[model samples]
Target: EPEVTQTPSHQVTQMGQEVILRCVPISNHLYFYWYRQILGQKVEFLVSFYNNEISEKSEIFDDQFSVERPDGSNFTLKIRSTKLEDSAMYFCASSERGVGELFFGEGSRLTVL
Candidate 1:
């Protein structure tokens, strides 16, 4: 069995700084997504990507945020500016089918100071 992998398991950054989170999904999966969970808060969907383009995005994925699949095997999320509200556990997930179960990566925790 394969799973999604995330880099920089933990990140500590000053407010207003830039941050990029990277993830690699299972080789055979197609649908990829980025989701976040603020401490003690519910997991929220940030964005979904397919066919190298954004398929869906939530209000949280504003102008300050962007995602890219720079290559066949990796997906990345970049935050132009860090805010206290942005501090959260970011999870990367992928699914073979568009509406089925999503295999998730161990979250990358971001702490904004």
Candidate 2:
């Protein structure tokens, strides 16, 4: 079966630096999303993209965060300026539609110091 792929499973960065996390979502899915979980908190939705634009973005998706589909299979998240609080497991997910249980990658762990 096809599955989501993430690169640099673990990333360590300094505060105020920029980082781009990469993901390859499931091949046949039409909707893509990014969610993050702090060490001990609930998973929160950051943004959802479809048709080459953002469909919905949560309040947490501020000016510093951006998402892009650089190519047919690659989806990326760029954090222009990281903060200590930005440390978390950044999860990439995709679904057949907007309302469904998403299939998630193991995740890209972001640690900012």
Candidate 3:
């Protein structure tokens, strides 16, 4: 089955540096989303994109963050300035049905020093 895939399972970065997390969502999925889990915290939604535009976004998606579909198969998230609080496991998810269950990637772990 097709699945979402994220690169660089772990990353250690310095504060204020920019980081780009990469993801390849399922080929036929119609909805894509980004969520983060702070170590032991519950998953928090960052943004959701559909039809080539943002469908929903949470407060966590601030000026420092951005998302884009750079190609037919890749979905990317860029953080302009890293902060200690930004340390978390960022997961990429996709679903064929808009309201159906989402399939998640293993996640890219971000660590800011």
Cα lDDT listed for each candidate: 0.95, 0.95, 0.95
In candidate 3, which residue pairs get closer than 3 Å at backbone N, Cα or C atoms, i.e. clash?
Answer: none
In order of appearance, the predictions have TM-scores of 0.97, 0.97, 0.97
The RMSD of every model to the true structure, in order and in angstroms, is 0.6, 0.8, 0.7
**Deviation in angstroms for 77 in model 3?**
0.6
lDDT, candidate 3, 1-113, per-residue tens: 77799998999999999999999999989899999999999999999999899999999999999999988999999999999999999999998978979999999999999
Give the Å shift of residue 29 in candidate 3: 0.3
Off by over 4 Å in 2: none
**What is the RMSD, in Å, between candidate 2 and the native fold over all Cα?**
0.8
Show model 1 residue runs off by greater than 4 Å: none
How many pairs of residues collide in model 2? 0
**What lDDT tens digits, residue by residue, belong to model 2 across residues 2-69?**
89999879999999999999999999898999999999999999999999999999999999999999
